[model samples]
Target: SNRFSYSMNLKGASMTIDTACSSSLVCTHVSKLHLRYKDNEIMPASVVNGLNLMLFPGPFVGCCAAGMLSHEGRCFTFNSTADGYARGELCGALLFKAKQFNPADGGLCCLAGSQTNQDGRSASLTAPNGPAQEKCIAAVLKEVGLTPTEVDCIECHGTGTSLGDP
Candidate 1:
């Protein structure tokens, strides 16, 4: 209710989506489509934000989870050793609009698309399949006509589990 009135100004030109961990990423993908294919009709400037709060104490009983919070103590981003300390946080935010702002306004940091899928068999609500991981990578490559060798680094999901690592 806090931001609904503000959202009304966005109208049919805007959208609100919730995809848990991948929420912001999903928004970026859509914005890219709008920019590349629908720019003539839609001015593609957009603002994206995410927030994570680690409040469920019961979920980590007897677990030694470790993670770092943002300098302001608000998020746990890309920290290598991040554990259950990972919450639905202010994960990130982006301000972008197709053709609305020129790159020189501020250096243009290029945006790329991502593909996300479920493993289906969440055997323990955490376990993920290696084949699924491998396939997801392959699917992205096929869509973009690129190979793994061309990519530099990968931001991994460090849920403090070896199984989840793969």
Candidate 2:
């Protein structure tokens, strides 16, 4: 993060978040909040990055032991026969800016809002609570003064497991 900031000449606050599967989304959520919380003079923009790399076999072995790796070696999310999710690596970043700073080209797209929630009573660590997830989405839409129909897209965090996929 520091290296990227140095290269880009960004001096605002920067940090890393490691919440496993939801790390990227969590980073995005935080960035959205930061863009909204601070004034233009302080921080009118923010950058969020997430990387999942398996440089070693420790995590692979651990997930295998915990039966978190799919036997078919593929992710069958939302499927009834899903055993687990397929593990992989990804590196991505997103730039978030305040509405007032929108470029003349209109930029890529606008991030209306973001929200995070946890399922304390989930069946397992990787399991997703449908109700909790629904509540979180509802809250975000309501906070943004929009209904379900107005939503253009929803990037979700899926685990491939039967309970986790939903």
The candidate that achieves the highest lDDT relative to the unseen native structure? 2
Residue-level lDDT of model 2, residues 1-166, one tens digit each, is 7888899999888888888777888888888887788776788778888888889999999989988888999988777777888888888777777765455856877777789988887777766667988899899988889989987777765677766654
How well is each residue in 1-166 modelled by candidate 1, as lDDT tens digits? 1274276464324666676556666777766666667644556465555555557865344343322222233333344433333334355666666654457878466654466677786575556677887888788778778888988766555443334432
Candidate 1 off by > 4 Å: 1-16, 37-40, 53-91, 99-105
Clash totals for all candidate models: 12, 0
Worst 10 residues of 1 by lDDT: 66-75
Candidate with maximal TM-score: 2
Error of 1 at 9 (Å): 4.1
- Estimated TM-score per prediction? 0.61, 0.87
